[model samples]
Target chain A: MATMTQSGKPADAIGLAPAAPIELDGITHNYGSRLALDKLSFRVREAEIFGLLGPNGSGKTTLFRILSTLMIPTGGAARIQGFDAGREPNRVRQRIGIVFQSRSVDVKLTAAENLKHQGHLYGLRGAHLQQRIAEVLERVGLLDRADDRVESLSGGQQRRVELAKGLIHAPSVLLLDEPSTGLDPGARRDLWQYLRTLRDQQGVTVLVTTHLMEEAEHCDRVAILSKGKLVALGSPAELKAKIGGDVVTFEAAGPEQAAQLAAEIRNRFGAAGTVLGSTVRVERDRGHRFLTEVVEAFPRRVESVSVARPSLEDVFIDCTGHRFWTEDAQPDPAGGKNKRGEY
Target chain B: MATVAAAAPQAKTASSPGIWTPAYSLWLREIVRFYRQKARVAGVIATPLLFWIVLGSGFAYSFHSSSGSGSYLAYFFPGSVVMIVLFTAIFSMMSLISDRNEGFLLSVLAAPVNRSAIVLGKVLGGATLAAIQGVIFLAFAPLVGDHPGAGAVLLSILAIVLISFELTALGFAIAWPMDSPQAFHAIVNLLLLPLWMLSGALFPADRASGWLAWLMRLNPLSYGVDALRNALFPAEHTLFPLDVNLGITAAFCVLVFAASWAIVNRRTHKPAA
Candidate 1:
């Protein structure tokens, strides 16, 4: 596991022999006047399925581009297998395979043809290239459909072809940007299963960026970002454990009603509860007992109340002081500009 | 299926991709993609053929050439060939905009390939297609009653290759910085269409007035059109000798290709997409 110090420096060099597979040492990026990444730093160990969880404008897309060597940062550095991404992009490109959020495969070509082209780009040639193409197609469980044109494949199968194209070069690190954007439920499950197989069997380190909490739950470790800063970094269970208590919610008719109830509860019990829209949430130990006393104290004022264990979303709220999907965080339909108003 | 014993990828000294492999692969992709679209092939060839017939006959009676070529169709034959080359070369480079929009170019940009190879592959691919289309138009030389010897035919083919290379490079330079096809179409119509119309393709430079004649002389494509005229109609009077015309066209090809290479290699603060 990788650790971070209080000063936001990676503690991986504390008697470790080999460097981590992917490391961001104070990687900062600015799109014009807007700062997209604010001195973010972390380390990803080898063969681990790491996730970058953030909403739009959290700078994960900018960081993804930097890691894939598509964009250079304004400040700091991203290193892949110890090669700086900005200075020696070709070196970084050779060690990493990138699966973009958009479709990158040539739809006119068949699956095998796409892989062959990708193989040639990485210096593979002749009979060896053909064998590797077949091997990768088989690894993605698409060998039978290798001859079919990508235009004819279903969306899930086309995504698998993209995975095969990335794997044909045998890169040590696989970087995926929103790998499950349009996948169906079953296909999404299958995609995660294949990722686990790749990590456990081939020892390929995978770094994925996603906004879905359920997707982040499937990762071995996740780094959560909000407003271009690292808020929490750990396994799902470990980060959820940091909440230290159960979460209790009181739902009212409207924001005004919820605000009134939140003020009364804070005054009477000397507890702090956050009012978000039409709900007031409080985190406390023995949440069931606290729930009963609060409901009894203000009958019908709290229209509904519930107590549950702390989830990853609660950890996000605890760190960021806001919900994961705020009203203003909706993605722009015009493209290029993210939720943070950065292009 | 349960085996988890795959060998780890060994770390080797990273080698930047040389020109040949990536260029060849990209070039091969262009060829495959072009052949797959049957309507594109038909339209690229047929549209120019239609214009050659309609415009050649439409202007035949109303105009008489100062060059003493018997009919307007013969005078317009090489011009139509040039038109075919122009349309194919410029239109083929439009794929670059689509490639970028569809995210295919992003994959290529992320690969360990050289930037110059990208320009080379794409330009050469379009040039090859354009040259082939121009030659296919050349096969109709007999219909215009212009019969040249084997040497002249070979020279005409060489002129078409140079013309296609230069035009495709020019189009590549224009298309690299643009994102939308609509903007590219606007630039093509405003800039390139006039360059072709004044290149002695439709009218001989000697017959034109002072300023239009000067414009023809200043255009690099004028030299190419003159070279084709010299090759296809050996007996007809030409503006310049064959050697001088080809030399200028070749120089333009190198210059435009270098401009495209520089554009691709430029490191900007903005995203490459």
Candidate 2:
């Protein structure tokens, strides 16, 4: 396990300098026989939008809960702003603000009242607390809706209220567990804009966990996790670059036909082709040239073909051997509509 | 860029330790919550008042001969106050269960606040609410029957506060480990109903059966009831042979409070299962 400074920059990074606000060290947690986080280690840099990208059941929420001091690790340690999460949780909590995956805002109370109550929990009160509440509500672009009950707000607006509640105390580090899980595209964009502003303007370290590939792209750095292990960690470009080349994908009739097409393409291009369900993916320096050859070689078998730059979605599929939107047990994407919401 | 310049420096100062911040703030919030929930406030006041009016009248004839010095309502007024304190304290503990389920408790735990502060703040807040209800019930005692001396009234109020604190602590300790609100309420019903019955609240300890007398002697609620009765009706002899039932009740209050505080603080600070 590696350690980092309060800025979340790796202490061991040569020229980069240490800048992280949170660090995890060899964290391994288990519930009975089932392992949740297996030797997980990562750093969230200060004033940077860091994303913990993982599919559901990949221990993202577990890590978030531990970092937020809701739970302790079964083994290893987590540090927030130089305070140990396990041994000095109050110190860590004092420095960090958290928004859980679930909507934690009090539905019975108005948005402003919820923020005021949360502010009080952290000892903010009177005019200072009221000012902070107004400031954060404005930051989330929900200042006008502050007097509205949370239950009366739309799902997206309610999420914004939750964000405002988390930021009411102006924590040094903010932990958001899938903050935009149920938002529409416009709402999500607005949220991302607010997060960016929070990072750039306030110098507040923002750590978020999301399965949304496009959302993960907004992060300054991302840690792609699978089965509780961080399989890839880097900037979005660096992670996509790990695929080595542009991704050429084509679909066939079935898995058997896809495998045969991949084999034929491998034989013709002398490059490795991987079969995922009825789709075959081949990576090459020049995706167009490879696609032309594959199309010419298996014209009848190749039902559809597309060539594109590698994305976080493709990177996730490449590393985990599963599509980002596809869930366990069902190969058909439509069978798991709600599962996508888990990200 | 201009906004960033203004907000960044303030962010650095946000995490500074303010030791009293969490407690005082949470305490004030609980009080505000109680005030806003009008139905709950009315319920807290009405429970003991109902017992005083209905039960005091129903037992009025019996207490005329047995109680000796005063009317039945007079004899039962202090007991009613104790009962009110007990009822309010136990019910208020259910808020812990509510807060935990609603994720408010988790939010508080995740904050920089001290665990002991959370426990003490909750206990004191609940006691304060219960004290208010007890005081309201005390005010109605004169209307229902006999009025105690001013010193006795003050002493009865103090005893009610102490009883409320003890019961609130006990309720917290019981409710802390409970997973669901239903389970917590069930436990409260199970523990409180029997404890209240055997406390001599409805009857004098001397009139109780031999087995019942032994149970009353050991019941903590009995001490509270006995102390309040002694303060209210100064003419009646002590419920027990010893003249130190108040001392015993005070000890019981302290013991219950310490135990409750320890249990709640430890439970809240422990890593969530």
Candidate 3:
């Protein structure tokens, strides 16, 4: 039996310089006629918490499926640590821990039992397996409930056990989909805290997919996807910083009034102003000064005005020409035919 | 620090715990999961007993074959044992569908284990469960007045194991691509149960009219049913010779198992298709 030996340990595991944990080179996929991912390219550096951000039809789920070795890509390649994910899936699977968006733990089995079975799948056994199970349970703060059935545990606790099951193998890269889906705010925070700890302490690379912008904020870097294309990719702060200056919006009484005010602001201040329904939005460098200048210029034409820093949501809107969430344009490209993970 | 560094690489990647480890683990899981579900255990025992009593006794007084050595109840004994094996096998394979729906199958698929290990684990587990139930129903043989001695019992047990393996493999084949338990049941009732019915279990193959007799002769399950009959009634060599029946049953096990393995080890992981 060929077993993993000690020589393969990277320098990063010993707190040395990190290696590129994951690299996706022009990964493309199609669900029949719908192209889920379009020439997607990105690289996640070592010990980094990376997020794949998208909406229901934006293809994050498809990308997650490919990277987790659940689905092979229609085109291009995904490599985990140096091994190709599609071609050498078993080797990729050995180095990665996957936490699916949906519940994967056996509710009927005890926490210890679930971990035991998972350990066996990874070829861990005997007293060594038991010790690893205990360690992972303790790390998840569920050692006390090790013997209890998963059905007896709370939703948050069950999610933690799912994490424990993944961590039992202690792979270098952890991929999760919608990790905060069922978790309450407190549990969500705890989950992020654990992810950060794993990155800092164990140098484990974390890659996650999320639809929520706030959730993406916790990641070290985010790849904003829209309609199967990489719209934006950078740290949350850097992406926000890249948008530049501030966003100023003026709420007028009506669309006509807002349009009239936008025209005046465009001519007077030479700031690009667009009427967005009943509000006129302007992007400027010195937003506060521009807000006062615009308000004084318009007088009673502007009912109220506000200026704020750019958010990840603003970056998403700026890149995609839409809000983070849209009510009318429900572009479910898969046609809800596949029930696995749309949103 | 050197020792920790040496151990750190082990954490980076998983080891292969020999060829059979994953199969053993999955097999153990099936057994553990089966024992934990009290309803499944009750269902396993009660359904066979009920079928044997209700169906066996219903035909006991009414059924008068033109030529037979014993009562209909005795005639139905071996068939009832095969029924027990079938029901347990059905129950075991049904979990495969449920497992796929509930996300456990996804986890297993992502594991570093080989696909053949998965097939071996699940098939062997279901076969073991069905075999146990079949043997338990064998204890009721004395009540039906067909209690053969030690050699007969040993041969009958072999036939039961062969039949159990073949049926469980057949169940795995049926349940492989199915997504829903309802669909699996519908197909089993429509196709699988009919296979057993025409297998000379309910009625003798020799008595069937022309084409129907040929169908019984062709049905692989008939070989299993006929093998059991030969072992139970060593004196009555009607369907086929004992050695011939056992050989065919063994061959049936391999055929169905190969069919199952082919389906499971097929490349893509699309469960619905």
Candidate 4:
């Protein structure tokens, strides 16, 4: 595999391993008085499927904007292939492909037309541009539908066109912001499969920002964020293994009862329970036996009990000391969209 | 399926692409989008034609121009052409708001293209459509009992093209900061409509009294209408000489285009919304 370096020097020659395709060096961003990203730093290894996992206000959207060169950070810098995303935005733009959370493909144009226009922006033209467009469409499995108007295509097909548009210029790094937001389960599975193929076959470094835990589980490594801070960073399995045992969850009547139950568990078995809303969670090696002992000690007090292997959500709770979905993350009963960047 | 390139391009950081190619691509997109919507093409032409016919006929008896010999319908022909230009040139930029809302603008902004190119491409696209519509309306000059020589026809085309460019650039400036088409519509009613009405489009500047006359004299579009009126009707008395009107109209075109370019580039200096 060939390693891409910004300085044009081989990675081994510079006494460094394979150069990171994307890097955020103490990046900070604030919307007016509200801080969206707080001196956050991370590096995505070359050709890896990296997931930026966070709840709505965890600053993933802001980070995505910075990486795509749509917005300059307030402080520090983001580098794609070692080019500054803020100061040298056009260069950064050339090296990275971006898929926005919202639909970016023009519905009025045919899929090929959209890709042709996108290619023109990156200075691709003539027969070379057409060949590139056809190649990208084929990679996304949309070659036959290239002549179809994007509006006529299914939502999944339209998204594939967007992916084709991003890939037309042959970018080294592909950045997707919630690529599977509107996708059905089957479409989403296809999207992940395609992303994996891009990484495995073309060596495109794929970085996806998603709020879905299941989506993060598919990433090779994930960066979990909370309140604009990096709380955990590792593969999902590694992060879960950090908890080192089974996850025992207990549901009580209310927050007060959950906190009381957590305190009792700490005092009785010397196991600390994390209280989240009306539930208490404790990590134990022999969770089956521990569940039996706890349930017998307080038969009627505990409403529900379950023991299972630690999932990514458990890792999140273990790191952040809260539930994955806060009250604000819940869907509004009145049908208002959840506000992002409020935390 | 053909394979993607095995390796990254590994090209050094290159400067942003020049203005013309991306501007042309964006321009092509606007034209394709406009013509694809058959209703937009019909509405832009039909609404003004309807307005000109009904309004010109109704006011034929009630209003009279300073040029006493020509009928009100004949006198309104140049103004009607300007109306077509204004509608096609100005309202076409309403696409910017929709583009932003639909995430199309986001993709363009993220592309490695110059900001000035964006303003140029959009303004030129609107101007092309507006100019074409205005020229089409000019072909109906014979219906109004006016016959122009070849020189007059060529000059009128020039005047229409300039007017189209100016109005489209002005629209780009107004629509750049606006996120909603409703706000742009409000601006059209408040500023653009008043600008046209007071530009001696409805009545000649010579007939208007006092401050109304001053407002007409101060209006840049008044010069455009004056220039077009001179071209289409060589016998009619124009508010300003053809040369002076074209000069001022040309200057305003440059001014508005520059203003739009500045507004767009200024957003880049700040955090993009």
Who wins the TM-score comparison?
1
Runs in model 2 lying further than 4 Å from the true structure: A1-19, A107-117, A123-127, A142-157, A325-343, B1-19, B55-65, B69-76, B240-243, B267-273
> Model 3: per-residue lDDT, tens digit, B159-224?
999998999889999997877788898999898899889988888988889999999999988888
Q: Tell me how far the alpha carbon of residue A70 in candidate 1 is from the true structure, in angstroms, after superposition.
A: 1.3
For model 2 the TM-score comes to: 0.86
Model 1 C-alpha lDDT versus the unseen true structure: 0.87
Give the per-residue lDDT digits (tens) of candidate 1, residues A1-343: 2344465323432332445789999998877677878999999988999999998878888888889887888898788866688887887888898888888999999999999998888888899899999898888889999899999999889989888888878888999989997899999998899899989998899999998999999999999998789999999999988877899999998999999999999999988888888999999889999999999999888889899999888888888878988825634222364211122
**Which residue segments of model 4 deviate by more than 4 Å?**
A1-19, A327-343, B1-9, B12-16, B267-273
Q: Using TM-score as the measure, what is the rank order of every candidate, best first?
A: 1, 4, 3, 2
Please list the residue runs of candidate 3 whose C-alpha ends up more than 4 Å from where it truly belongs after superposition: A1-19, A253-264, A273-277, A299-303, A327-343, B1-13, B66-68, B269-273
Q: List model 3 lDDT by residue over A223-266, tens digit each.
A: 99988899999999999888689999899999999888888887
**lDDT on C-alpha atoms for all candidate structures:** 0.87, 0.76, 0.83, 0.85
For residues A1-343, write the lDDT of model 4, one tens digit per residue. Answer: 1244687543432444444688888999876676777999889898999999998778887788788887778898887776678887787787889888778788899999999999888888899899998899998889999898999999888888888888888887999989997799999999999999999988899999998999999999999988778999999999999998899999999999999999998999999999988999999998999999999998877999999999999999899888888724532211123121111
lDDT (10s digit) by residue, model 2, range A174-285:
8898888788888888888988888888888899999788889999999988777888899999988888879999999999999998888777778877788999987777
Stretches of candidate 1 exceeding 4 Å from the true structure = A1-16, A330-343, B1-9, B12-15
Screening candidate 1 with a backbone cut-off below 3 angstroms (N, C-alpha, C), the clashing residue pairs are none
Cα lDDT tens digits for candidate 1, B184-211: 9999999999989999999988889999
Model 4 chain B poorest ten-residue lDDT run: B1-10
